[model samples]
Every structure is written in C-alpha cells, then in structure tokens.
Target: MSDTFSPRTLGILGGGQLAQMLALAAIPLGVRVVALEPDPQAGARLCAEHLCVPYTDPAGLARLAKCDAVTLEFENVPLEALDFLEGRVPVRPGRGLLAHSKHRAREKEGLRAAGAGTADFAVIEAESDLAGALAQLGGQGILKTSELGYDGKGQRRVQSDAELRAAWDDLGRVPCVLEGLVPFTREVSLGVARTASGNLAFGPLVENVHRDGILRTSVYTGGDQRAEAQAREIARAVAEAWGLEGLMTLEFFELPGGELLVNEVAPRVHNSGHLTQDGGGVSQFAAQVRAVLGLPLQGWKPPLPTAMVNVVGVDGLDGQALEPDWGAIDALPGTQIHLYHKAHRQGRKLGHVNLTAPDAETLRSRLAELERLIP
Candidate 1:
C-alpha cells in the first residue's frame, strides 16, 4: 500500500447523489472529481470539479486520460468503457465485482463461489428456462431480476405455474434469475469497506423497512452478537473473493430459525447506510473516499440509537420547497438533514434525515416529528 492516500484526480462513472456525496467527502482530502453523465442537470453535476463529456463517448475516454483513480457511483456503467480505462486508472472494486453486481444470477454465483449463504435460486436465460426454474422451486416463486433493474422494477411474483410465462414476457423475456421467496422475519444490512492492503471494517447491522420494495427506513439494531459476527465474516469474504477495494454493502435476511441469508449486494455506498452521516462517527461516504484513496483505517463508532428516514420527492414539490419545513425535525437534538438538489419528479429520492438519541424509542419519536415536517 502507498504511504500517501492522495490521488491527483478521481473520476466517477455516474453523476447522481452518491457521486455528489462522494465528492463532498473527498473535499477534505484535497482530491478533485471528474464526473461522467449524460444529464448536465444531474445532482452531482454541480458538485464535481470537472464533468466529463458523456459516458461511452470517445471524449469521455479522453477525460479518463487525466484521472489517476476512478470509481462508479452506479452499477449501470458500460463495462467496455471501464475496460478501456482499467490499466490507465485504478478502478476500485475492479471490473469483476462490477460485472457481478450488474446481474442477479451472476451475483448469486459469486456469493456461492465465495462460500456465502444466499436464497435458493436458479438462472433464467430464456422463457424455457423459466419453466425449468419453476419446476426446480416446486412452488410459488419470483422471477429474480433483469440486469439493470432497481427500486422494484424488472421483477414479478408468480403465484402459479400459469403466471410464469406471463411474468417472463412482462420482463421482456430477458435473462434473469428465479428465486425461492424466503419467509424471513426481518431484513438488515451491513455496510463494509476494504482497502487495497486487505484491511476491512464493517458498520453494525441495520434493521431495514421497505415500502413498495424500496428502502424507507434503516434503524440500527445494535450489537446482535451472532448476526454481527456472521455479517463481518460475509463482508470480509466478499472483499477477499473479489479482491475488492473501496466500499460495498451486504443486505441480509434474518430467517425464522435465527439463520442469516444473503439478500443482495451493492458494490458501492448504499441507501441503507445513509444514517452514517449523523449516526456513525464515520459516514459511509467518508469511508468510501478513504478506502478508494487507500487511506488508513480509522475508528468506528455507532450512534447508540439512530433512525434514517428517506425523503422521496413527489411532483409539485417546488411550492413546498420555498417554505421548507424542518422545524419539528430540527427541534430534536443531534438531527441532521441531507437534501439532494434534484428536479421535481414523482417518487424521486430527494434527501434523508439522520436522527439519533439514546434508544430506538427516542429515535422513532424524532422520525415521527420528521414525517410531520416533510411538506
């Protein structure tokens, strides 16, 4: 590992709030970021030092010429483009991890290869494969995912064998995975970071609540001795397996019998850990910056009790934006607000609030206050 963490220039593949937050974290390290996105009005566009021409453009390849290390804000980046820049600039997490993250089938295979536990599933390459998958599951199941799917998109729940064909067509008969739904008691996530030198660190398991299949709140469960230990081991194996560098998140399901099963993996800073900004002494964004830059590990502390509420913007929010209301939420001590500047769009993630207290009850109360304040 290099003694110094400084990089002349850092290039980011997507220009969303994640990139914006990453740029915010890199500021103290004196590193400038170059962002690549098609939208000039993207959230991170204003924050990055230099915005590259466009992803997959020849000019974008030219922009990579100026960067020392590159990272992705999202998993949808064209792999061919990253392949062109790999030898020239350091791409944290590397191409293999990125490739695995893009597809659900491959992700499960990677997890199995790493000796990690995951939900029972089968690969679906064509419509015929769907029937074979259903036969294997032997009962009601779900068509796992299409490569680029997010936020409940590109998935269908099949109740009977009859629905399998329709579900397959609904997903455009694309390559996917079919997973046996688990009757899990709760869903949680453990965010982890790995440096180039194999140093690993993990945040505690967070209890996640989802609405419409998108994460709504992530509350700290705090010190589940067994789950925490298993989570750390799982995260470490993932990092070691991919020989991954930088940050990634592992979402897990706590089964009825007290066993933990892997849910999904995000090879980047995740929405579930947004609370780290105020709860943990080290925010996930800050940790990611440090890891990607090869900085030394630091202290890890949890905000004994904390709750993170995601703020989703609905249309016609501009009227409410002018008189932004945080009075009730702000009244709570140790509360922090993070707003992403994005144009009004239905169900778009606007920002989040991290409220902390001595216990989950107090944290819930503060979150209730925040809900009332959201205009």
Candidate 2:
C-alpha cells in the first residue's frame, strides 16, 4: 500500500484478455502478475510470469497465495476456491460481491436493494415454474442463466410457453432468472473503481452495441449530467452498500421516460469501457490496478468523445493479418487496437480498438471509418 512499495507478485484468476490487459497496465508500476487459467493459449498467458495450474485446483490457490495480493479478472472463479484462499491473501472485489454476481437472481436482488431500477424478474428453478414466473413478468421475457453465463450464452428469449420449456431445458435445467423484456432506448454502462480505503471514482458513460450476445463496439458518450449522475449515484451506492474494493462496471438500460434499469454488474474491468484505454484520464485497467493495489482513485475525465471496437473471429480472414490491422488502428487518428494473441476461435474475444475524437459526432464518424477497416 505504500507509494514506494513494490509487490513481488500479483495473482489473477481466469487469465483472459482482461487479465492480460491488467498485467500490461501494471508493468510501468512495477507489478508482476501471475495468472491461473486452464488453457495455455489464454490471452493473459502471453504475459503472466506464472500460471497456477488450472483453476479449481486446490494446489493452484495455494500456489497463488504466495503473492502479495490476488484478484480475479472473471467472476466465475468458484466461490469455494476464493473462500479457501481468503484469509491467506488479499483479494479485491472480494467474494461478497462476486458471490452475488455469479447468480443472476442475486444480482438483480442486489441491484434493487441499492435503489437501482431493473426489469421485473423472478427466479425459475424448474420447467414447471417457468410459466408462473413468465406470467408474473407478463408477455415475453428473457431467461438468463443463474450462474456462469456470459456474452449471451446461457440465455434465451421466451415469447411462448413452449419456448420457455425448451429454453429451460436448453440452459441445462440450471437455476435461472426470468426478466420481462424492456423497450429500452439504448444500452449504456458506467465503470467505477473503489479502493480499499473507500476512495471511489466513476468513468464516462458508454453506449454499447452487441451482436449475437458478443460486444461488438462501445461508443464513449460523454458525461450527460442526468445520465452520468444517475449511473454514478447508483454505482457509488452499490459500492458503499457492498463495501466493494475494486473496479466494477454497471450495465444499465436507458428506457423511455429517461429511466435507467440495471442490466448486469461486472465486478471487474468491463468490455464496454475499452475506450478508456485511449480516451480517459486513466484506463479502467489502470484504475483497477490502482484500486486493487490500494492506490488513490482518479476522477472521471474523458477525452471529449471516444469509440471502442471489438475484434471477433471472422471467416476466410488470415489470422496473421491482425498485425497489419494493428498498424492501421494505430495510424488512424485517435485510435488504438489491443490484440489478445489468442488462438483463432469463432465468437471468442480476440482484441479491441479504442478511438477518440473532439466531439461525439466526430467520434461516431471515426468509429464508422474504423468499422470498415477492421474487417
């Protein structure tokens, strides 16, 4: 926690692009990251100094515990693993909040308790219970997995009773949460960081666009007093309520009548805030590192307007071509692309590009230009 204090090692769970980016951001600060992931080809493996075997391995937690502090890039790390290591090493955004995020029902319940708005929902544990929950929600709704679902996985839209039953089966009959469909205007997310000392910081609001459950692009819409204030107020309340001490992103639905409904909560650096790397006072990764390391939080200040584009696997495109594309993103005005160095796989997150401009209109135009250039 000292300014001159250097940690010999930082442990990370779920070594994906998020961990990789956190490691990259921590280098200048003299922090070394060790990650635990099953796949050797994971994005963070390229950078982490050590891999703690595979996650869920008791031996792995024991190994990672030798570090000064442990943090998880993904929330899916089993609560048991974290609980086992809790007293041995410091884990930021600790299990208290993460335990809730792992389940959709708990997440919604927590959001409502924090005075945040969300679509009407009910917990669905059986196929027979689906109809009643759907009826309570009225008309059509989306069924989200209770645990371990992300990027549109483990979820389905149920408009009919037949679809509800099949959707329940499709989700492997796991405990689920049913949410009434919202006629949302757009999806926006707010990224906030809270330090162990209770210092909190909020970032710019971003309008996100997702395709097939995968985030495709994020447009950094500058702080609207009403929108940003609402999001910030809600995030701060959640952090204080949960006593969260790490970076967290709150995804919200901006609905008609200017109301915002909580969509989901990500207790780490989020995909929607990728634009912060190039356009914010401090990138979300940097802020996360700062918070987890017990450093002071930075205030929210965006570079006018920013746009972030994600790179997903595409057919017939040589993976080797990514190098030149990186050059293109770098050469373009106010744009930066981060490649995850992951093995080619369909629908997997490969990397992201952050672009900024002097204004929203210019940012939009630049984003459109990059869109054509990416593919």
Candidate 3:
C-alpha cells in the first residue's frame, strides 16, 4: 500500500457544489482538482480548474484524462465520456457503479443481489407493461423514470391503470419503475467509504428529512446502535456487490417495524452527508480523495449529535435573489455556513448550515431552529 495518497491532480466530472466541496477538501492535502462542467459559473469554478464545456467535449475529456484520477460529482455523466477515459485515467468507483446510480431498475436489482432490501417494484418497459406492473404492486405505486430523475422530477404517484399510463406518457414513455410505498417511520441515509484494499468506513446512519422530494436536513441524533450497525453492514455488502472503491451514499426507508428498505444510491458525495465537513473528522470528500489515490481509509465515523439544514434559495424564475441575513445565521451557536458560488434558483441547493451539540436532543432543537432560519 502507498504511504501517501497519490492523486496530485484529481478530476471531477461535474462542477456542482459537491465538486466544489470535494476540491476544498483535496486542496488542503496538496491535491489539485480539475472540474469539467458546462455551467460557466458552476460552484466548483471557485476551487477547481474549471473546464466550462459539455461532459463529452473532446477537449474537456482530454484535459480530464490528464489528471491523476477521475471521479463523478453527480451520477448523470454520460457513459460514453467514461468510456473515453477508461484506460487513460483511473475513474474511481468506476462506470459500473455509475450505471446503477443512473438507472432505478438496475439499482434495485443490484441492491437485492447485495443482500439489501428494497421496496417491491416492477419494471415498466412500455405502456402495455404499466398496467400489469401496477397491479403487481397492489395497484398503487410511485412511477419513476429509470434514468435522469432526481428530487420530485420524473416521478408521479399513480393508483390506477389510467394514471399509470398517463405517468408513463408524461415521463416521455421511458423505461420506468413502479415501487410500492413502504410504511416508513422516517427516511435515513448512510455514507460509506471503501478502498482498493477492501477496508471500509461508515458515517452515521443519520435520519433524513425531505420536502417536495428534495432533502432538507440530515440529523445524527445519537442513533440506534442496532439500526446503525445494520445500515453499515448493508452498505458494506452493497459496496462489494457494486465494486465500490470510494465514497457513496445510500438512501433508506426505516419502517415502523424496524426494518430498512433501500430507496436510492448516489455514486459520489451526497447532499445528506454535508455535515461531515464539520465535527473535526474525516469527511466523505476527504475519504474520496484518499480512496481515489489508493490511500488507506481512516476514521469510520464523525462526532455524534450533528445536523445539517440546506439553505434553499428563492425562485430564480420569479426574478428574485437570496439576500441572506448572514449575520443572523452566524450568530446562532455552533453553526457553520457553507455557500456554493452559484446563483439563487428555485429547487437549487445554494448553501447549508452544519451545527453540533453535546447531545442529541439539543442538536435536534438547534436543527429545527436552523431549518426555520435557512430561507
């Protein structure tokens, strides 16, 4: 094993805030980062070598291949772009993991194969399959596209054949999955890190709160020992099944009966894991930098009783700007504010607040207050 993490220049496939934070983590360790993104003002431009071009632009891909290694900031990077870099650069966590992250049906299949439980679902390849798939799931399901869906986009709740057909059509008649809704008590997410040597580390199995199908907050409230252990074990199993080599975040639905149903997975640093940057410990971004360089993994967990609230900005389509009261947020005790260098847009994550307390109850209270103040 290498005594030092070796990727002197890391390449990221997208230049969103996740890329921004990843570069911030890497720079402290003397690793330079390059980001290829179409958005000229993308967040990573502040901290990384920005290539403001499409993901598949030949010149952009050529520049990325010059980096020591490559990874994704988001899962939707076109597979052909990866194919172009396969032998030219090391793409940690690789294209197979990206494949599952890109397609809901493949993600479920991979999860089941990995000994992780998922909500019962049927694949809809066409309109003729939608009715039977709906009936198989008790005639009620969330119809979601197999690819290119996130947040509340590309999904619809349907209870009948007509509704299912309509959802399929509305979603552009793409391949889809209709999943039975689980009777969940809460949603949770776990960030897992693995290395080429097969070492594994885990973040807390933190409870997550979402609104309008987007994550609003993630809180690690001195979580249940048994459930946390189970979540980590499941993550390890999934990592093995998926050939994971760096950071990945998995979403789960915690049922009232104390079981977990895997909901979704992301191949890079996640919105829910943003609290990792605080607490004076190794973050998912740091771990990713190390993993991509083949460095040893360290620090399995973060300080307990931490929470993060996303600062969603105003509706840009309404021609509004976010004039945040920065002083007000800074005045709140233990709050660390991180803003992405991007314009305010509705449904876009502009920044986040991470805070901690000596215990879980106080942390939850602070989180509620922070959430109220974010907008």
Deviation from native of the Cα of residue 234 in model 2, angstroms = 0.5
Query: Residue 289 CA error for candidate 1 (Å)?
Result: 1.1
lDDT of 1 at 306: 74
Candidate 3 lDDT over residue span 1-375, tens digit each: 234844389999999898999999999877999999999989999999999999999999999999988998878888789889999998987987877878999999999999999999999986577657877888798989999888879999999989988888888898999999788999988888888778887877778898888888888765678888888889989998899978898999999888988999988778888887886678878888878767777753666678898888765455776555678778888889998977777778888889987788888787777777766
**Model 1 off-target regions past 4 Å?**
1-7, 299-301, 315-325, 372-375
TM-score of each candidate? 0.92, 0.93, 0.95
Decreasing lDDT order of the candidates: 3, 2, 1
Candidate 2 lDDT over residue span 25-128, tens digit each:
88777888888888877888777865747677888888888887888888888777787789999898898888777779998998888888899998898656
Highest lDDT against the true fold, candidate: 3
Give model 3 RMSD, 1 decimal.
2.0
lDDT of each: 0.79, 0.83, 0.85
| Cα-based lDDT at residue 213, candidate 2 | 90
